[model samples]
Structure formats: structure tokens, C-alpha cells
Target chain A: MATHRFDPNFTDNVINSMGPKTSPRLRQLMTGLIKHVHDFARENELTVDEWMAGVKLLNWAGQMSDDKRNEGQLVCDVIGLESLVDEITFTLADEAKDAPTATAILGPFFRADTPYRENGADIVVTKPKDGEMAFMHGRVMDFETKTPLVGATVEVWQASTNGLYEQQDENQVEFNLRGKFKTDADGRYYFYCLRPTPYPVPDDGPAGRMLQLMDRHPFRPAHIHIIATHDGYRPLTTQIFDRKDKYLDNDSVFAVKDSLVVDFVERKDDPQAGLELNYDVKLVADAK
Target chain B: MATHRFDPNFTDNVINSMGPKTSPRLRQLMTGLIKHVHDFARENELTVDEWMAGVKLLNWAGQMSDDKRNEGQLVCDVIGLESLVDEITFTLADEAKDAPTATAILGPFFRADTPYRENGADIVVTKPKDGEMAFMHGRVMDFETKTPLVGATVEVWQASTNGLYEQQDENQVEFNLRGKFKTDADGRYYFYCLRPTPYPVPDDGPAGRMLQLMDRHPFRPAHIHIIATHDGYRPLTTQIFDRKDKYLDNDSVFAVKDSLVVDFVERKDDPQAGLELNYDVKLVADAK
Candidate 1:
């Protein structure tokens, strides 16, 4: 019988042949990628059908992507890859004792060039139907010094209570529920918006099919996304999850960090019948 | 700083949630896939840019694939995954010691229901431009008995010397280099065709870009594909490589098996002005 055992030199041959003259960083990345992927296939004894299924899923996800939607990013998020990579790469240096705000995946909905507004500006241009108003106020501070970071840029966005971003729903005004605000002299920023509600990710695409096949829900917990930046501090991108959202413990993207969850206090007497949430952001110093 | 170390339970959480009610085999597969992918990301400290680049590559490959071309399959082939899986899954049973023919990937080009032709029939319906003629003859035998298997279906195909398959080139007639022949009572089958030539895989897509980035050649060695099937014997799919082909040692797909390589002898006096090749295929029985 012919030898069917694993070839000892296969990995080396593939790596050496494919990575000879690329940039050093590219070579290193490719080598590690090849080794891990090859080892995974061998260890799993992956069958042809399984491999073909994976290819088909990826193909479908690609086909589903468009200028406004990124199905591939959704796939990565659903598979927990986006969050895992974010966690790994955003780890703070050990010497910094104070805890900075945790990082979250910059999901596919982010759009640049949002119009800047003064602190405490109401971001909701058209009130969403069946949506309860909410006031999200937060303070931006330096992690090391505990000093307020005045004039910090706080970019905030979240899906409507209907779980659709402005770009995704034609009924909503352009850039609805999206705005940029500056921290006041007291280092506080606030925006009036609809309370986020737990919603399923787009379920009509290949990523949704993958989630279904995996027996997992496609829901992400109610959350508000924020990107806070100051001149002398590292940019902080994170999401604040409502403490009462049912999907918090089982966020589809695995992006819910304990420190990023906050409670929204119900303010029944308010004219808008709004909820109030206060969160504090801490940014790491840019350098030693 | 907050704990940024690897979440010890993260792997288990993903696996358990994603695989709760899936089939046992699927559960096992998903579990392994999640672990390996997460571990690979963490180990490589994969940057966001690198991850997004991979996503873009996959997206491009999917967009490039359609009914006629399989860019995703090409990606798998160039990554050496198709051949690796074929090798692992096609290993012969230990008890059936007689060496059966080796297997290769059923590439994306294979189409079912090809028309059958009589023995000694020439498969090249249109003489390819700048192509050298070749006459290929082979016998199908039972591995254990060394006896001919009559009435076996021998399907054959190959790219022209110009490195184009019939479907790929408009000038070539439909099914030009593709045909099926039946073995005679002596288990012999013969067909006239062009000598297979080394060819670059379609390099205008994502897979090609990957090859270029890796500093690797995209050429597959010269080879002929055959699939032999008899009523009571297991079907054998394989490729016969031209021993003199320069790419034999470094086929883009890593499909060059030592046992599948053969010499193509030149015939000076033949009317066809062709090369002659003889291959004997040994098929294992269906059951003990």
C-alpha cells in the first residue's frame, strides 16, 4: 500500500515557496496563517462536503455584500472572530494600572463625516415610531490622571428601536440616530435619542443562515456605540449595553464586556417619557 | 488595567452556544473550527487590517465565481487544501493491501453526462492550434486478481497544449478534449487526444492575487484526468502526470502523487504524429 501518512515537509514547502520575497510582516503573517489553517484541516479530518459547504457559505456572504452592507463583516461578527481579534489587539500595556474603556468591534454600520453638534444636542431628527426617548450622557476622562478631557470628540450612533440603522431604513432620515458631540468644559457629553432595543441582525443573508445552522440566535443586545477621542489620549471605541437586555449574556458577536454594561434609569415624569443613562469613558495616554 | 488576557471560557462559550442542537458530526466540526480559528487569531496577533484584507479577498473571489468559473475552488486549490483533503480522505483500507489507483481532486471543470465514444476514438473533435497529438491507452484491472475488468467506463479530459480547456476556448469545439470510452473484454481502452500542457490557473481573480502576493507560481503541471468505474468495483478518480513536466515537483494544487506520474513516449512513425502513453489502473473491490 502507498504511504498515506501525513507529509512532514508539506508545511515547510508551502510556507517557504509562498513567502520568499514578500514584506517581512506579510511573510510572517502568511506563514503563521498557513501553518494554523493546514493544521486545523489535518486535525479535523475535514471532509470534502464540509469544505465545500464552507466555500459556499463564504461565496454567498460575498454575493450578499454591497456598498451599504458588508455581509462578510457580519459573518465574522457572528462567528465571534471580530470580537476576539478586538480583544486580543486592544489589550492595554501592563504598566498602566487604571482601566480604560474596553474596545468593541466597529461594526459595519459606521459612517464617516457625521455632522458635529454642541454638547446635549438631541440627535434624533425624526422620532422613531414606537420608540421611547432616552438621554445618554457620558464623561470622557484620562485613565491615568482621572482628569476630565474637555473638548473631546464623542461620536455616537445606534440603531432605532425598530433595530434598523438610518442607512438601512428608507423611512428614517439620513443620519438619524447618528451624531457627533463635544465634551463640555466639565468633560461631559449628552445626546437625546431613542432607547435601543434588542434586535436580530440581518437574517436574510448567508451570515444569518450560518447562525441558524449553528443553533444560535442572531440578536445583539440593546446598545449605544461611542467613539471618544482626545488629542493627547488614545481613541476609545466601545458600546454601552443596557443592563436589562436579555441578550447581554449571549450577545451574538461576543462583544459584551462586563465593564461596558450600564443601567438605564426610567424617568416616568419626563415630558418625552424618557430613560436616562450615564456612562464614563476613560482613554489611555498616547505615550509614556 | 482590566483583565485583557485570553478569556479562558470564551472558546467553550462559543462552541456550546453555537453547536447546541446540531448533528453530532456538525457539532464536532464546528467546535474544532471555532477553537482553531480563535487560536490562530490570538496566536498571530492578527491586526484589524489583516483580517479585513482576508475578508476582502474572500469577497472578491465570490464575486468572480459563476456558473462557468469557480474562483472559490481555485482559492482552495492554490492554498493546497483541496489536495490535502483528498489525500486524507482517500487512503486505502489497511486490509486491502493491493495498491489501488490514487485519487486527485475533482476540479471545478468536471461536468457530468459526457458522451461516450467507441474504443480508439479520437476525443479531440477539433485539432487545437499549436497542439501536439497524443494517443493514450490504458487497462482497468482488479487490484487483487490482476484480471481485466471489461465494460468499465473510462472518462477522460485534459487541457490543450495551448493551456485551455474546451469550455475555456471558443475556438475549440464543444467536448473537444472530453470523452468517455468503454473498456473492451480485455479491459483495454484507447483514445486519441492532445498532449496535456502546463497552464496557469486563471489569475485575474482573488486567488490569482493571493498567488502573486505569496510570490508563488500559479501553474499546474501537465496532466490528464480519468475516472474509471465498473459495476462491482469502486470508482477510481485520478490524474496521470507527465513525468517530464517542470511543474511536477511544485504543482499549484500539490496534486502530484509519485505513483500517478508516468512517462510519455514519443512515436516517430505514427500517422497521428502523436506521443504514446500506457497506464494500467488497479481498482479495489467494493466489499470484503
Candidate 2:
């Protein structure tokens, strides 16, 4: 017998065989995804055995995720897919100037809303034993015009003194070291809270294991999380890392920026600032 | 002053943080995605320097693709994402028994519909001036019952005697050695053609370059393309390969199977067989 030949558009036939029209967007997405995926199979000359192993890895990734934790996201970040998408979204805003604030990944720890309080308030109502007190103040303004954005809202949050988000540690207060403050007529708002310390993202997950297997480190630098907003301004999601932290250059979330780094000045017993120490912030409005 | 903490589900504030309420799905996807992306940044301690390099890589992958090729797919495939999705879809089929024929990637060469033809006809109407004539025969069947599937239509195509798909070789005849054949009453189909030798997938593309960089090979095993179908029975889109080919176990497309490998016996002069070749095909209704 000679080689009997034929065309095998197996992929198109199979996908088309799935029936009914899909939205152009979704179709384009799936099609593009499929092409890349299939091309990969061809390019690697992937064997059946190797293909099966990939399936098992994904299953393990899924198993590592739960209500209290999601390891899948961590894996995505490590593999660079998360950053790729973030870069895309970040670019949608104006690129001419420094982003009003450093736009960074909103780490897995954020929960919606902190209680709103008047200016010059504290977020750490019940202080956890571990972290120190830091009084933070910030004013929101248009980056180009340098005009203060009065009535702007600034939400601040941080891990408990034990170096964990409230959700991650059952022992911590429900929303410890987290609060919402609105700027006064001068576009200034202040809040006091326990200082954040370097913490490790859950290393028990598949992502952590991969990092370990790959010999990559997992510590994130200390940082205060903030989301600032004002009318006609693009909301800014950012973090302020301690300049002295060891992992500042390697903040696992890749959120650090030169301008966003702040010194946690020590004021042993300064009561005039209403707390043991004071920190100041200059906010830039989210632009169109 | 103190940090004012609130409930984990601080509806009034965090809710207000997101301008317009997103659909539950969008919210879930975005939040999960954001967290993971941010986490990756944190874990890698990714700095602005490294982030720029990543952006550059993505741009390169994108620029590598064009109308005649898809490099992005190749990159994703090598990373195992393509196989992950393929396996997921395979496992999630409505019924394991209803699986369609083992589907593989449609290489970039496929161009819509090839010219259709009649039953028991030769597809390679014009053979390479230097290649030897060979006769191929096969029968389409229901794999589960091992019964002949009469009246089934089989469409076939392949690269010319040189072993290059039509789109890739401008020197070869357009739609060369490509045609369709309907299975006879006895479920047998035969055609006159030359043996197809093993060939390399396009290596000038990004996938090829990546393979080169990774020290991987690009050769696909010798195989004949065939698609068998009949109404009421699932369509079979598959290929039969010569077992002796060097790339059998390492098909770039991951398309080979134990059952798909068929021996191509060498035949001497036999005028009665009209080119001295015998071929048979065995097929099953596209797996449920």
C-alpha cells in the first residue's frame, strides 16, 4: 500500500462542530487562543505522554485553590500572564507622564471598603501586638496642574502586625489596619495604623512549590496599600513600600516605584503628630 | 487618632471604589486576576527593570506572527498551556464515548476547502517528475463495531511529492495531490499516488526559531491526511502514518497514535493492481 493522502482540518472541523454562533469577541479570543495552543503542540512536536503530564499539573493547580486561598493567581503571575495583562491595562491610560501614582498589582489581600472616617483618624482601632504605629497623611492632586483634589477619598490598608491580611489570619481583627479617609478642603487626609512588615505570600500553594523548585525567593517588601480617587480622575491603585526593607527591589508583587518609596521616619515619642510617628503622601489624580 | 477598621464585606466603601458595578463574573475574574498578577510581582520581587524586559518579549512574540503564520501559538504551546486546554476540552466532552476523532492542530498550511472529487479517483493527478508511482487503498469503518462504513466521503490532501503542503511551496502545483473520495458500497476507497516522505514544518517562523534556540527538532513523521464522514455518524478527521518514519514518536503536532500508524508495504511490478499497491482503512464513528 502506498501513502494515502488527505487534508485534516481537524481543529476547525472540531471547533466548528461545537455549533451555534458566538459573539465575535469571544470567537476571536477562542480562535486566537486555539491557534497559539495548537501551534505550540506542533512546534514542540509534543508527545502524547508529555501532553498528559501538562493536564495533571493544571489539575494540581486547581486543587491548590480554595475559598481561603487561590494559588492559581500566583502561578499566573509567576508565568508572566498576569503581568502581561496588567501592562496592557496600565497602558490604556496616559503614558506621557509618570502614572499619577505607581499602578501596581492589587495583591490577593484587598477586601472592599474600609470604614470611612473624618480627617486625622486612625485605622488600627484594636492594635495587634506585632506591628508598630505609623500616622500616614496624604493629599490628592492633579499631576499636571498640581491642583489639590479636595473631597478626594483615600482608602488605606495593611497586613496585621503579624504580617498577614485580615482574611488570611483568623486571629487578626476583621479589617485590621484598614480604613477610608476623605481629604479636607486642603486635599489632605490622615490616618494612623500599625506598620506593615515584610510578609510571605502563601508558600504552601503550587506556585510556592514551583518557585522553590525553580529556586526563586518569595518574600514581599513591606508596603501600605492605597486606592485613591477623585471626580474626573482615574482611580489609582498603588502601594507605598518602606525604603529600608530588604525586598524593596524584589517586591514579589512588582509594585514598587522610586517615587512611591517612603522613609518610615522614627519619632520615638512625638505626641504632636497624634501618633508615635508621622508619614506624608502626595497623591496624583487618576487621569483619563 | 486610630485606624478605623470595618467588616470584610465593607459594602459602602469598597463597593464605591469600583465605579460601576461589574457583573459577578467580571468582578470575580478581574479581582482574581489582579491579585494573582500583583502576587507574581511580589513573589518575583519584579523590578521596573525586569518588567520592561518582559514587555519587550511579548512585543517580539506578537511581531513574529503574520497572515501566513502564528508564533504566539507556538510559544504558548511550548509552555504547555496549549496541551492543558486541549486535555480539559477532551475530558469535558458530553460523553467519553462520543469523542470525535482525535483532533490535532491545523497547521498554518490549511486553506479553507480543497477541491472536492469523486469516488475511487486519484488525487495526485500530477506526480513529481522524479517520484515513483504508488497505489493506496483503505476502508472506512465504525471503530466500535469494526464494521465497514459504506458510502462514507473521504477528503484527502497533502504536500506534493516533495512533502510540502501547497501553501508552503510555490513551486509545487496549487492544490497538488489533494482531492476527496467517497467510500464504496464495500466501504473501500483507493487512490493512486506517490509515497509521502517525512518533512519538516516551516522553520523560518518564530516557532522554528524557538525550537532552534531550545535545540529541538522540527520534523513530522510521514503521514497521509484523511477525513471520513457520513450523516448520522460522527465525522472522523485523522491521519495514517508510515511507522518507519524517523519522526513518528515526535510529531510536531502531537497527532500520531498507536492505531494511526499503518505499515506501507513495498510492492514490485504487478500490472493487474494498476501500479501494484494495496491499501485498507479502518475507522470508527467519531468518538461520541
Candidate 3:
């Protein structure tokens, strides 16, 4: 009998080791993935037949993808890999520096170019009675100074009064319910657009099949998108969902941060305002 | 800026406040699994979409399962999870304790009922000309006593001549090339079976698709399966693959152990032996 030490890479003994040298980051990621994947297999006593089935599904997912839609990316997001990455990114930030406003999955619908507009300009985008007219005004200010940061760009978009994205609606005008506005000297900016309504994501693709399997709905609450940016301030790509939305708490993307949920107030018979809405503005500097 | 402690489980924030409440073994395993899974999720920046996709894949894997076929298990084997468990299981014994022959993947095609035969019986299983007959003989000795152990059952199976498993081949007879042999008083046993041929796994399924995606081929070398057991002996489930097989260094399941490879020698014109092929075997007992 011979004394022996356990070899960690026992599998490499028979299979000629030919893997490329991996960077620290990739090694860490692959190691972690392999361990968990291995554990999952052991816990389930996964069989060969079952494994092949997974391969087939992944292949199908790849085949389902096209230029217009990335089913693979959608699948990756649904599996919580995207959120996991976001969380890791947040963790890697310096403790002294607060993270930027929470980032969410850009659900494969954001367009590249949005028309810019002047401050206080009406970005009504379209004329539709399905959505209520709301005036949104906000200011970008230095967090410490409490002073508005003038000349900041605020790009905004929202689902129509019917709560469906313009891209999903062939009848809706292109870029309807979406526009860009710049802040005035006082760092104030206002826009006119119908309030967004809750709507379901496309349920006809492979992602839909996944949702059906989990018995989960694919609805997102009414929300107004905003991409605020200035020279010094960190670009804030965020959205504020209507607190009154039916799916406010159960947002499909898990993007509903507590601070990002806002109540839509109603004001009637305001002769001076000349509208049934009172808009308010607030600004804070980026946390250091 | 405020100083913050680098606390683990920040989001869940569920510290193990109740200390020492569980067995150390269970606690270690649970903690290890949690950390591994969480780290994997973190490293992958796994999005909600990806998470859902994984979950959906799992659910679909379950849906595609049947009593006779388990693709999940096969995946586990291919990824070497089962082999890892087996290594942990057998390596617990001290080095002075003889190690049993290495165990490999049982694969998804094995069955329980194989014909039991006397010592030196022929288990040609298929047509005589389908594959070359090999007269295999081996001794099961108690390493401590250096004595042969008789009355031990040796189970064996292999792929047919056409590189296809009985489970995968509708044309092959049930339990083809499968049998169990008991050792004679001399601790030697021999049986005739068709030589195995390298075969590809089911390529039409998800597992096949995964291989395609990764640009990997699915091929397992020709091998003879064996599980030898006797009273007070640790059971051994191992396989002896032909050394000349093309897939020897590239087994898909990572089941090929260095010590498990054996050569099949050609013996021509041996009138006394009346055999054309021969091979030797060595096995260590399982320490109690």
C-alpha cells in the first residue's frame, strides 16, 4: 500500500489539460459557477438524459434569438444573472462613495436617439385620451450645495395612456410619449405627457414560455423613464413608477426601489395653474 | 461620508445569531453551499432574466423526464459532479487501506438485471461475429491477507459492436453484452463479451445542443463496465477502457482514470486457451 495525497484536479489526470490561462476575474467567476453547478447536480442526482434536455433548451434559446430581440439576454436576465451582476457591481463600490441610483435591466426596448427640447417646453409627444395629462418638473442640484445645476439634460419616456410601450404598439406614433428636456437657469425643467399605465411585456417569445412555467406574470407598472445628466453629476438612468400602479410592488424586473415610487397627485380648479396638476421639483447632489 | 462595516450577507442581513444550533457537519455543508451559490450569482452579474431562464430550464428539464430516462443525471455525470462525489466517498479511508478500482459514470443506460453466469462462461450477448471475444480473467484479493476472495460477484456490461447502447438502440436485444460472473475458488473469473465501440451520446436532445454551442463533440470510448463485491469488501464500480481508443484522452464525462485504462492483447493460435484476446485486471478492496 502507498500513501497518497488527494489531488484537486483529478479529472485532469486522464484528460490532457489544455485550458487557456484565465485571468483572475474569469477564474473566480468560473470557479464559483462550477462549484454551484456541481452542487446542484449532486443534490438532484441529475442523470445523463436530463442533462441533454437542458442542452437542447439552450440551443433552442439561441435559435430563437434574432436581430430585433435578444432572447438569450432576456433569458439571462430572467435567471437573475443580471441582478446578481448589478449587486456585485454595487458591492465593489467604495464604502465612502454611495452607489449611483439603482440600475435596472434595460429591457431590450430603449431606443438610442431621443429628440431634445427646450426648458419648460411641452413634450406632450402625442395626443391621446387613454392617458391623463401630467406635468413633470424636476431639478438637478448639487447634493451638498442644494443649488440647481443648470443646463442639465433630462431625457424622458413613458408608456402611453394605455400602458404599452411605443415600440410594442404599431398604431402609436414613433417616439410618442417620449422626449428630452433641458433645465433652465433655475435648474427647473417641466414636460407634458400622459401618465403611464401598467402593461405586460411581450408574452409571445421564449421568455413567455419561461414565465408560464413559473406561473409568474410579466407585467410592469406604469412608470416614467428619466435619464438625467450634467457635467459633474453622475448620469442617472432611472425611472419613477406610479405608486398607485396595480403592479407597483410586484414589478416584473424587480426594479421598484422604495425611493423611486411616487404618488401622482390630482389638483382641480386651479385658475392660476390653468391645469388640474401641480408639479413639484426636488434635487439633491450625488452622494460622495 | 460614513464608514460602514464590511458585513457579509448585507442584503439578507440574517446573521447566524443563534450560534451552535446545528451539527458542525450539516452547518459546514449548508454554509458552504450558500456561499458558493451566492458567489456564483454575484460573479456572473446574473440578471433577473438569466435567473428566470435557469429556473425555467430546470422546470423544463423536469417536464422532459421519464422513469427510464433522466437527462439531468446525465448532465451531472458529464460535468463530473458524480465523479467528484465518488472520489470523496472512497478517499475517506487511509492510504494503507487498499483503494478499490476507480469508479466511473454508470451512465444513463445501465440496467439492474444482467444474466448471472458461472466462472469462465461465455457472455457473447450478441452475434458471435458482431465483436471480437475477449477472455477476461481477474483476481479479487484481500490486500491485507494477500489472498484471493472467491464467491465475489463481478457485474459487467459494454456497448455493442456498433457503438450503441442497448437503451439507445431499438434493434439491440435487451441486456445485450451485460452479465454477472462469480469468481472460482482460485479467485479468477472469465467471461466472453463483444468488444465495446466508441459511441456518441444522444445528440438530438438538449445535451447535444449544449455541446454544439460550446463547439464540443460528444464521444465516449469503448469500455467494459464492472462492479465487483464480496462480504467485508467495499464495492467497486469501475470501467476498463481500451487504451487505443481515440476518445481515451477526451472522454466527454471525464470518467477516464489513469489507472483504469487497460490494453486488450491479441492472442492468435492458442489452441489450449481457445481464445483470441486476453486482458489482466487488478482491484483493491474497500477498507471498512
Best by lDDT: 1
- Ranked by TM-score, top first: 1, 3, 2
- The alpha-carbon lDDT assigned to residue B6 of candidate 2 equals 14
Off by over 4 Å in 1: A1-4, A92-97, A113-121, A184-186, A268-270, B1-4, B92-97
Ranking by DockQ: 1, 3, 2
TM-score of each: 0.92, 0.49, 0.56
Ten contiguous residues minimizing lDDT sum, candidate 3 chain A: A271-280
Chain A of model 3, TM-score against the native? 0.79
Worst 10 residues of 1 chain A by lDDT: A91-100
DockQ of each two-chain model: 0.60, 0.03, 0.10
Task: Put down candidate 1 lDDT per residue, B56-143, tens digits, no spaces.
Answer: 8888877877766778888988878887777666652423464578888877777686799988888878886788888889799998
lDDT of 3 by residue, B23-82 (tens): 554344434444455556654555444454554444444344454455655555555665
- Clash number by candidate, in order: 0, 39, 48
Writing each residue's lDDT as its tens digit, candidate 1 over A87-200 gives: 776753423555577788888888886789877677888787688788888799988788999999999999988889988999889888999988999999987887789988
For TM-score, candidate 1 versus 3, the one ahead is 1
> Per-residue lDDT tens digits of candidate 2, residues B1-288?
212221112222212223244455434433443433443443333444345444333334445555444555554443334434444444344245644356444344555567666655566665667665567777777757768888877776666656677656777677777777778888887777666678776666545654454445666777777766776575545567777788886666556666667766666674422343354544444443
Instruction: Please report the candidate that would top TM-score against the real structure.
Output: 1
* CA lDDT, candidate 1, residue B196: 86
